[model samples]
Each structure stands twice: as C-alpha cells, then as structure tokens.
Target: MTNNDIFKKLRVALKLRDDDIVKILSLVDFRISKSELGAFFRKEDHPKYMECGDQILRNFLNGLVIHLRGPRPEKTNNKPQKKSNN
Candidate 1:
C-alpha cells in the first residue's frame, strides 16, 4: 500500500484530528500545516490530493512514538560525595 493509504488508516484508527496530527508530527520536529495535512486525506481523484512521501510518513511514525509514549526522561548525573575524616 502507498504511504497515503497507511497514513489515512492510522489516522482513522487512532481517531486523530487534524490538530492532533499536526501536534504529533511536531513532536518529532516535523512541521506541517493543517491544509497540507488535509490534502493527505483527500480522495485520489480530488484535485487537492497530495501524495504522502516517505519522509512525511517516517517522521509521523517517529512522532507517534513520542506521542504514545511520553518523551524519554532526561539523564541525571549524580556523583556521590566523598567522606572526610577529621
């Protein structure tokens, strides 16, 4: 199946709206306009239909990972203090 098909199915399965999708894509530093996203959902025959590219799909998947599971926690450096004997 094409990337567009996969994207459309995922969107419906996740019950995601345009805004939600935009946010999800943004999670991975991918920026997309609402109108551009709408183009992906349009019927093939529609003049405004825009084919989903591999990069868009890849980014969406990466973003979805962060969306579903919260972003990875930051690492902390904790050094134990040395004891001083008088």
Candidate 2:
C-alpha cells in the first residue's frame, strides 16, 4: 500500500539485513545511513517511524538492479580493419 510497506516486504523477501541494504543502495550512488534505514522498518505508531519517499524507493530499485545483475560494462569504440587482397 505505502512505500514503506513495499520496502519492508521486499527487505524480508530478499532476506536483506541493514548493512546489505546500505550496500545495495550504495551501488546506485544512493547513500543512506543505517539509522535512517531502520526508521523505515519501524512500526507506524513508533516515534521514529519514517515514511519511505519516492526518491529513496526509486534509488533502491535501481540499486537492486545493479546488485542482482551487476553493473553495466563500459563501451569502447573499435574501428574495422581494412582487408587486403593476397
């Protein structure tokens, strides 16, 4: 229903710990502290409960992509060689 809900479910399903999540987020150049991450998992009624934002969710999804599939390879230019008749 909510971003926090979705994030919580995914984290459980993926069996990811706080550190693992931090690493995954880092893969996409998104930085999140462990304490901030913990807030997302807190109960809704809890004082430290923090709603997950679109940017954070989007970055997590992007980072998950890189984490699972590995980073894309860099492209290089290579000119075709001319053939000579023997």
Candidate 3:
C-alpha cells in the first residue's frame, strides 16, 4: 500500500482529525501543516519529511506506528536533508 493510503487508513482507525494529527506530531517534535497533511492524505504519495526524506514509506509507516503504538526510540538509517526551523 502507498504511504498516503496507509496514512488515511491509520487516521481513520485512530479517529483523529487533521488538527489532532498536527497536535500529536507536535508532541513528537515533528511539525507539519494541516494543508500538507491533507495533501499527503489526498495524494498517492507521502509528504516530504525532514528527518526521513529518502525513506518515504518507512517515514510514514513509522509515523503511523508511533501514532498508534505510541512514541518509541527512533531508528533512522539514512540521514535526512535539513530544513530551516521556520
């Protein structure tokens, strides 16, 4: 399954709104906009990630698992491109 599809399914399963997702991600130190999240959900691809850009599916799956399974020690193999903390 695609990242977007997985994300949508997870969100539905969790019964979370976009705002709720934003809040949850904030708790984990990952900030993203609702529009971006919507785009990710609407599109057939995962949104670009600052910490796991190269690992699109992995990044999304990790996020879903974290949301469902709660926070855990992060495991990242590939370095991600740095984005300015705007």
lDDT of 3 at 16: 86
lDDT of 3 by residue, 1-86 (tens): 65556667877987889887777666556777887666766543445532223344455555666777787877888878899998
lDDT winner between candidates 1 and 3: 1
Could you give candidate 2's per-residue lDDT for residues 1-86 as a string of tens digits?
99999999999999999999999999988899999999999999999999999999999999999999999888976888889999
When summed lDDT is taken over every stretch of 10 residues in candidate 1, the lowest stretch is: 72-81
- Quantify how close model 1 is to the true structure by its C-alpha RMSD in Å: 3.1
lDDT of each: 0.96, 0.96, 0.64
- In the range 1-86, model 1's lDDT, one tens digit per residue, is 99999999999999999999999999999999999999999999999999999999999999999999999899887888889999
lDDT of prediction 1: 0.96
| TM-score, structure 3 vs. true | 0.53
Give the range where candidate 3 is weakest over 10 consecutive residues by summed lDDT: 49-58
**Against the hidden reference, what TM-scores do the models get?**
0.83, 0.85, 0.53
Which is the winner by lDDT between candidate 2 and candidate 3? Answer: 2
**Once superposed on the true structure, which residue ranges of model 3 sit more than 4 Å away at CA?**
43-86
**Candidate 1 clashing pairs, residues 3+ apart or interchain:** none
Q: What is the lDDT of candidate 3?
A: 0.64
